[model samples]
Target: MTDPSQTPSLDLPDGVAVTGALKPGYEQILSRQALELIATLHRELEPRRQERLAARQEVVRAIADGEDLDFLPETASIREDDSWRVAEHAPGLVDRRVEMTGPTDRKMTINAMNSGARVWLADQEDANTPLWENVVEGPMNLRDAIAGTISFTSPEGKEYALKTTDQAQLPTIVMRPRGWHLDEKHITVDGERTSGGLVDFALSMCASATLQLEAGKGPYFYLPKMEHYLEARLWNDAFTIAQDALGIPRGTIRATCLIETYPAAFQMEEILYELREHSAGLNAGRWDYLFSIIKTYRTRGRDFVLPDRNAVTMTAPMMRAYTNLLVRTCHKRGAHAIGGMAAFIPSKDEEVNKAAFEKVTADKQREAEDGFDGSWVAHPGMVQTCLDVFDRVLGDRPNQVDNTREDVQVTAADLLDVKATPGEVTEQGLRANIDVGLQYLATWLTGRGAVGIHNLMEDAATAEISRSQVWQWINNDITLTDTGEVVTQELVERLVDEVVTTLPGDASNYEEAKRLFLAVAVADEYADFLTVPAYEEMP
Candidate 1:
């Protein structure tokens, strides 16, 4: 086959090498044409991605140096302009009241679609581990799913497939690629690695966009961890280029930016403005959002330090402000404002499941009442509860976009109101944090990105927040309210030892998990994202 990178239209980067021979199923998804599309995109977008990453550090430095984090003064005009509206949601995305998110492994791909949710987020990012098989097979699974032919049979003899319902009845597929900070080292161009986000988007779009369109959906995406509006702009331009190259109409590629970063929370309006033409909406995300805050403010002051991962609920002052601003900005721009994740995985224990269901019900009700057009669910079992909540509020309506929260007036102070959260640091919270982080990292290193922990679907963001809380507690010399114990390196090390001994998993993987965890949590400087260094050490 001819080299896709050699396509005359693409100016391939010199010396760029495509290492790691294609895996078993890679050819179907990573075809010559698909590779050329990825190469072309890397040539077009990676430079801007680098710049945006650097821009992120500038904001972080400013926050760390005691400079206030808030909406950009220069972009005030964009925020003030209220006339702009995003493109209409494509047909399949109009009623995303209950969306399920999971990695695109064969079993998950089939189950998520068959689950009664309205949409399935085929995640190649947080919900996915970037192993070689996962990177290549994920798109293959999606391509088949889009074509309505995906099925999987487990070794235990259970089989999963798309339901016999009409194509219109299946959950719409929205692909989520990796964030800017990650690299697809397995594939290289001009002897250097390309952005993982570009690789995931290009391969999936090239392989499945046409199939999705033929089935009434277009190439939709859930962009994660974008720190600036310009990053959204970069994505918008890439969408334009890819659509043009594929001969699809402009705006065919719709995106919902996950407002999961500290910087992004302050620029929701501006983010919509940048992606207006291609924007389907903005999503409120909590894990990575909390991680960003604790990661950035680990050293600033006690006020900036967060108490505990589990204790910091959406009712927290900063979280409330962020969600309110997200819904308002999205509606004002004529986009669907998706709510945060319902990570509860139903359990066999009746009491545990009952309590979880109650918590999810209240959470979904709060979001629906707050004007969220839709929300995300992690497992199939929780879908109906979410759907029911939205159904009660949105009777005979596709969305509550009309119910814009005009009363919301989130200011810089509101966005940074970390001190208002009513929670006290405690010994139990510290031990829980340490145990969760260690457990998550161990599973992550063993090739699982999303894990069920304490009946919740935890991901990279959970581990991030977990270890970050420990680091902040240790660095700030925080005292536990219940035990009166001051968090110190000695105490953390002792806790880590105890947790590692009790952690369930392969013992060797646990050791590696602990080493990586300490590198980020106990180091002199904070790791921007835990997965950055962990990705390198991914054996």
Candidate 2:
């Protein structure tokens, strides 16, 4: 075990401190040079990050005060002209058929690399709870993996090590940092907290950019939770500075932005324009997209209030509009349009696995048919099914970028037609939402960010959709068609208590989960993101 006392005191910059424990060998990843570069980025980019976050709050306030969400009339010409295109794909990122996403712990790193997927998103964001040990240890594992020396053996004696043969078939490593809205309280610049997104990005980029290039893969990223083109502009600027400082070529780093925010959904063209020199593609951040819509319009009437989380399929009128717009916008601008997550995980029971595969196949089939370049799954078991569907469409070809989806034309009304999604608010949906929220939260409290729930992989975003939907349903007094139960704070508490009986775990953990769950689920103001509060409870 690494001793905290033996490590030399880091010559941290003014206003910064080692808020988290400096584990053994933390110095290797947090070298003096890397710290200085991160400080430079924090000093340079954090203020802009604060401004962008304020801009997001302003939008939320407008929607809260009866203003309708719509496209920016000012940037319509960028959307109309349609002549510009983002930079071509980075060399290693050309054929992304099945990208798997997970927290960047040691075991997940080895398995994800060997998952037979085209890309592995080393997530430091939604899928990961920012426990300090995890925050520091995650990159250590990645650094080793990049150097072909990563291995881990469990206490149970199950051993894992990187294989040379697997290296050739391993997924391209694309790191995803935290979003702009979060602050890295552990590190500060001039007594102010730095943006968590910049901290994760800077540390990883400063450490790995040149080395990745040497390995024939430029530093690639998946930008998450951006609410505007201005945020993308900020990242592009940061990329230039980092590259120049590191002596890497300009435009060598590529990023794929997740258009998860409702406001950003309207500015796809402008977002790509801002990152034109370094664009990879955009993602249909489907789960978070639902959470975003609710966060924006929770106070609006029933029209904007969604039915149930399960009922909002990709084919729902508004969802179809969003996905269709993504493929069209990305293909037209010469960027990849990656699809959403297939959260299905297999099981021991043949019948159970069969059902999961059937659901996942139909989902992947639709995405493949709709012109998505690639999609994601939660487990390795779902990879071949996604590959087969996309393979039938993209036989002998790495990608289908040449298939520009010209038949798609989406208007702003189509995007804002939230009430058009058909489904019933019901007793079953309410119980499921509450149950999923609590179950996932319990596991997260134990320092596990991703858990299998109902045979599907559930991440922080899954719980976000759950908790937010619960709050939305309660605030709206949504009526359940099946049981005629009106969702209320009192009723929700009762249901949570009932769910406690069903969840299999220590009573203490479930007790903690219940208390935290209700605080977010029953609060008058929507909690921005569950991970923010959950991180406070971590060791």
Candidate 3:
């Protein structure tokens, strides 16, 4: 933990304090204007943010007490009305055939800009570890990125910088802020911590909204982990206030909400309706969606239990329903329905790269055939693979939003058909979960949010899926299909111990990672999100 007395304090706005150390250039990112924007939003909407969070817990409690999750009756009219549509796509967002996502470190900022994707999801949420330095440098790097002066030089004397010669070829920038459940403890507003989402949004807006507008783009975002339409309303409220404060146009900011939560899957239309004026579309955040399924239904019987994370692919019946509904909902409302992430990172082994590319190609092809506008890729090498798939389907066209998918019909039961998913739990699967959970936590504790584990780019969402599956399996008394061994606390702990020995010796935070993983994986009451408790342990 950082001591307030040791950090450099800034001349911040009234009722705002900088508890984190401010490096020399950080003052420009957290300027008085930015602090004021965050402070104002925090004061006005923090209560409502708290209320929405409380509402989430209430829904969880209701579910535990035997209430079924379904579409909102109060917002049925919004879904029924066919006259409303989201605002038109801003410049550079119309043809988002491929998007690359990564944290805003200087090297990644430069690389993603040059990755040839149509948009770069400059992610500060799942792809970022919110160290005080990252909190400050994220906006700083983005500011430089917009200014077209971002560069990086590795310790080995290699050079990297943005492609300034052809400015038109650069990808549009879309930022993803932290979720509502998180607070920026490094900064305080009115004697309380401010929402990390608000902080990231404010600083990004203050630092680059006008610059991006001049560059033919506006303040664009990808919103994460919202459970209710009311949460979407709250985000729309934040976008309104931030844009007005920054003097941008009323709907200048466009947000693509990740329909990752189970309850959120049911409220897709309502969420779009709430943010229709400032909506970009919905994304199939598949990993987090899986994690949400396990978390939301963990307390239920074996009917809701999920098998290994890897076993539940996009082809699963429930997942197929989720994505099909997303594409239909977005097209019905004139929004662009984006696809899920392809996390395969190309490697040195030719056979490995061959198999991974084949899988990625098939995945993107399925999404395109389902009428998706675009999709996400984690590495630069796989950008062309996604581009080729979407290009084949969307040749000479920007997006396929005209196809409303009217023939597709999804019921609530279809979205909840976890029993139809094919796959069996094996001892190997459980060991993989334990290994991945501990490895991801260790790297995260060391300030890396995106790590390559077993050739796949693992993020916080993947880790959540890993740990949550362990908890759900243990709680539901799932037996391993291969070994006939029941999943128990003892089994998981033993696997954790065995996996720790095989972990990389250079993983500096190994022991804490082990402890943190077990804490969330075996606790009597499951942790809401692993990052909430893990944030307290961050340096």
Candidate 4:
């Protein structure tokens, strides 16, 4: 006998009072229904929830076990001023050239060593010959092919020179791995393997050959098909071991990693960060990445076969997402962001070639606009075009203005007045105003201590317009020069004195400002001019 007050009571609305438990028949029905609903939900969601939980756990484990994570060996830190070190050894920097040596508009094979590509890749994996033939012809045949006498019979029985006069202008060759050789432990000899035991041997061969080739001219390598951080780590380890064996410095070898797989996309930032000290840059491998995704994720029972390679376009959202991520990731890490390679343009027809060139030019322009510093061209004929596009897009301009200068207000009306017709404003007045504004922009961008100015305007064409105007003024020197050369410090001082003697309205201060601005702008622009061999000796 419990007291009624001691029992807990449910407070209910007037109409909804307490009731006894349901009858057995109704209770059994409700219990069965509830159990069925719960079972249905568990069947629907258990696998998915478990998958998510497992993935989350994997990430947590990876972070928690950081010591086990593969990382590049510690190397010497690169100074801010040393950013351009790779440029020194780059053959592209010297000749502004890259040549494609391959079968070329026909069924043929090519080697990286003889192609004179600053970076050569052995075409072992993709060559038509059997594994043994590729291995034998790999470097040896490439040497003979580079020499003057090699020739091959076309499928139609027409004779063609293997070593064309065009090869003379080619620069740097890069070797690519052939066959099913990811590393020493995974060698697909005769299209079969026993224990995946020789993968290290294959990787070592690649690392050794790459280092040997890089020893003389350009110290560079292009690492392809990197699927995981451990893959990259393995290569770096092999590189380290090879460098020690060859007496080369640990970080002397510069390499570019190809992001050609889905997993590699997510790990790009981590990979770049891991190999920051050793990596030259990362490239988007659109075709191979697509192939990998389809092969890895597509259900075996489904009819998900991809179309022909030529029919495929790099328009997939995933491809663009990966590229955007790579660009953002590289720039954030202070590394160069190289856009993906353009498709090899066919045909020597002038109209056909020009059209192809224009397409590539447009592609490179878009990349430059998106903040990529450079890209790859398969044909040597496209090299100059690529450089010209980059030059026009990345025109030399000054940095952003500091807060101190941002407050310096110029009325819109005054800006319009600077461009007044010849009769409306004197040449001196127009020149002085333009000189002042340009100087302010340049000084702010370059941090007075900096030498060159990088144009930051969104419209590259408009920046070029401004650059042309400034160069014209310096070249003509109608106002402040007696000789043809730029107006010197002494000439500027004399002009200021003369102007003070004649004109008014802050004339002295304005002249002094104009002189300072013009001098620095000229120096900055002149440095860029020196980069062009023809302009090196220009007055």
Candidate 5:
């Protein structure tokens, strides 16, 4: 354990306390100016953050009372107005043909920069655990990454460095900060923990926004887990304030909102309208969208219960509606329509690589044909896979925003057509959920978030969909197709026990992982986000 007395001190801004230990370089990242920015934002906007979060609970409560969600009538004017469009794409973001995403560690940063993708999503959200060290070092890595001085030497003597031969090929860095719902317990303002999103946004902007601007890309971001247009407005306000405080040009920061939540999907046009000045576009965060569906209507009935995670592909009818609507909304507003993640990681096995590559190729081809400007890939090896597909469609053009998909018209009923999704809940699917949830939680507790399991990169989003499905299954008494056994709380607990024994013994966190998984899985009340409770367990 780190000795509290030995922790370094900094000249913190008024009412701001760095309860987390400050390492040698941490003070530079959390400089006096950065703290001032954080403090100011906290004081000015914390109440509104609280209000938006409270509004989420209100929606949840209303849903439990059998309220069906639809586009807000009050915001109908914003959606109906076709005259307004987001500001033109910023420098280095005009052609986001292929973007790579991963946790922002020294090694991953170096590899992603060299991955040949157009944009690197330096993920501080689902793909990262907010360990105190990571909270400080993630921004540090990003700073070093932008400066072209980042390198890493693994304990096994393997060396990694950013490719200097082709500097122009370096991916534009688009940082994904933590969402509004989380708090940075290590940093307190007026005796209250500060917003984790604010901490990430402030530190990263302070450290690298100017450098990014000089490099031709402004401070770009991917906002996640927002459930309303008001949340987008909050981020727009933050961007305006941060740019002014940092002396960067107004509208220099461009952000793409992830329409992951069911509520967000309905308000896509309004969300774009809210951040039109600083909007890059919107991404189809598919995994989290499914999780949001289960979370929003888990109590409604079998109509809302989805099948196995693997069975629900992007081609599913309901998914098509969501993506079609996203593309239409974004393009109608003259914004980029980025597609969902292709999470398959290529393995050394030839057969596995061939099969996964075919699927990835088909997936990317579909997105390109569907008029998405670009899409996301989780692995460096898959960069070429995604890039080639977009290259074929885009040719000399930067993007396909002009393809407004005017023919596509999605109603509230279309977006909520969960029963139209094909596939079945099976015994194998149930066990996979149990297996993945426990394994992911175990590694997550140990402060590693982007984990590779069974040739796919598993992040917090995948784990969430996994465990949330289990909870929904148990509550609805879903029957496994193969076994004909009803999914009960007892059955889930028994499966959890079996999965525990099967986990690698070397992973010491599995015991705690089991307890945490059960806490979210079989609890009487559903947890809003597993990461919320899991954050308390982080080192």
Candidate 6:
């Protein structure tokens, strides 16, 4: 065992040592000040706290006395690991390779049978289909598409034929059921009997072996509009029922839930935990979540309105806060946190498109920095860009291992302490080490094929590797020198050229536009660093 008192003193940078010497006195003063502030707050909050406690007690008493209450089932039970049995028999779900959303959004269907993505989900919710038409023909038309007539458009604009009619060939294509309604008895949709509720219909459509025999692989489902843990549990229960009814194992069917609400953000851990055994992974639903936040918070009052559609900005702090929380939460639970959608492509004008692409590349870099494994793009035109970004950010590093600092200890005394606890003393040294390390890694990986830099604090070797890589990038001209120079258009352009376009495209124009946008956004994101002008020059 290590001796706490005899702990080897950490060799801190000079500024940290100076601050460490001055911390105790400042800590003493801060403690007194905090105590007085807390007392003042306590006096103000005591009455409201007492009233809330009393109200909660009354509700508890009412429940104990058996007063009727319409309680939703608790999510905790479904969160247990053993709640669902994994399917022993593999379902014959066909891989309907291509997914297409029409301009009007009404005629979504799958094509390129047995090709690219493992499963294809025909997007209906965000499509241009009229609600009534969707209620009537959405599922039926999709069913027909699955049964036959599916085709794909090749890059050369020629139509490639699909073998969708070969029921024995392709994976199952999943569709959202229309007019679904839930009640006491059997759930009903479009005058047909659905096994349970919305969830039951979904699982049955995706998990039945007999269905798999007809469809090839059993169909898969995408659960959207998820808001809470209980919502996930409800879906789990439906899946359980469907699996049992079809004599399949409990967790046979797979599903992906869209995280699209603020409440969903808070409940992400519980939701992922509840669906872990059956989930495909979580998709970041950017537009829907934004709409939900506006509705939930009623943000229209302050003239702080978002651009209607075309001119909207995705770099708002709130947006970053939500997505960052998502990345952290998903990694915490060992589940994939897919990045947000970047459905828009840069314009055809080479300069404009290149600039747009550059901005997107930078945005994706930020997402990669925050810990997303992959992102979504609407067009095949954007696939090369997506792959380029992923390759640059993901590099040759092994799959990301969870190194989150959940176990890091923080205390009131530590917060107030002026002297470093032989750990970290000066804020500048800590900041410099982090900045230097990250910048170095970013530089080194600039033109490289896939690379990964593990958390240095978690693995001792990672620190040495980081130091080595940083120097390598510096030497190779892959990374910017740490001479602390102000970032200029030339620097941004160089970084873009080095990192953004690994694909075939005349992207110069797009690159320029993206660079301008990124300059503004990055400056805002790192205002403190940008303001110091000198820091820009720091190596």
Q: Candidate 3, which segments miss by more than 4 Å at Cα?
A: 1-9, 165-167, 506-509
Which lDDT tens digits does candidate 4 get at residues 345-401? 446567866777777788777666666666665444555666677677665521000
Per-candidate TM-scores read: 0.96, 0.97, 0.98, 0.44, 0.98, 0.47
**lDDT (Cα, tens digit) per residue for candidate 6, span 1-539:** 54555433333222122111222122222223222322332233334434533443454345336432221246535433334432222343211112321211222244323333323444433321222223223344444455565454656886655544675555345443211111112212233222112422432243233444466455556566565565676567656655664566667666656776544655665777777667645667665664444333321222222322222344555565556666665555555556665544445568866776777677667766666666654444554565566667667642232533244333223211212212211222222323333332232222111122221111111122222222222222332224443334344345445434532334453343343334432232211111122112222
Q: Tens-digit lDDT track for model 1 on 1-539?
A: 75765433322335455554554456666666667777778888878888888988887788768898878899998878777788887879999899999988999998888898998999999989887778878889988887778888999999888885366888998999999899999778666688898889988888889888888778899999998889989988888888888899998899999999888888888888888888899999898998888866666888887876778899988889899989888888889999999999999999999988999999999999999988999999999999999999998899988877899998999988898888888888888888888888888887788899888899889888888888888888899999899988788888888877776755566788888888888888778888888888775
Ranking by lDDT: 5, 3, 1, 2, 6, 4
Q: Per-residue error at 500 for model 2, in Å?
A: 0.7
Residue-wise C-alpha lDDT for candidate 5, range 172-200, written one tens digit per residue: 89999999999999989999999999999
Output the lDDT of residue 539, model 5.
59
RMSD of each: 3.5, 1.6, 2.1, 29.5, 1.6, 25.0
Please report, in order, the local distance difference test score of every candidate based on alpha carbons.
0.85, 0.85, 0.91, 0.40, 0.91, 0.41
Q: Give model 1 RMSD, 1 decimal.
A: 3.5
Mind giving the per-residue lDDT tens digits that candidate 3 earns over 354-393?
9999999999999999999999999999999999999999
- Find the number of clashing residue pairs for candidate 4: 31
State in Å the error of residue 478, model 1: 0.6
Question: Which 10-residue window of candidate 3 scores lowest in summed lDDT?
Answer: 2-11
Off by over 4 Å in 1: 1-16, 505-509
Error of 4 at 140 (Å): 3.1
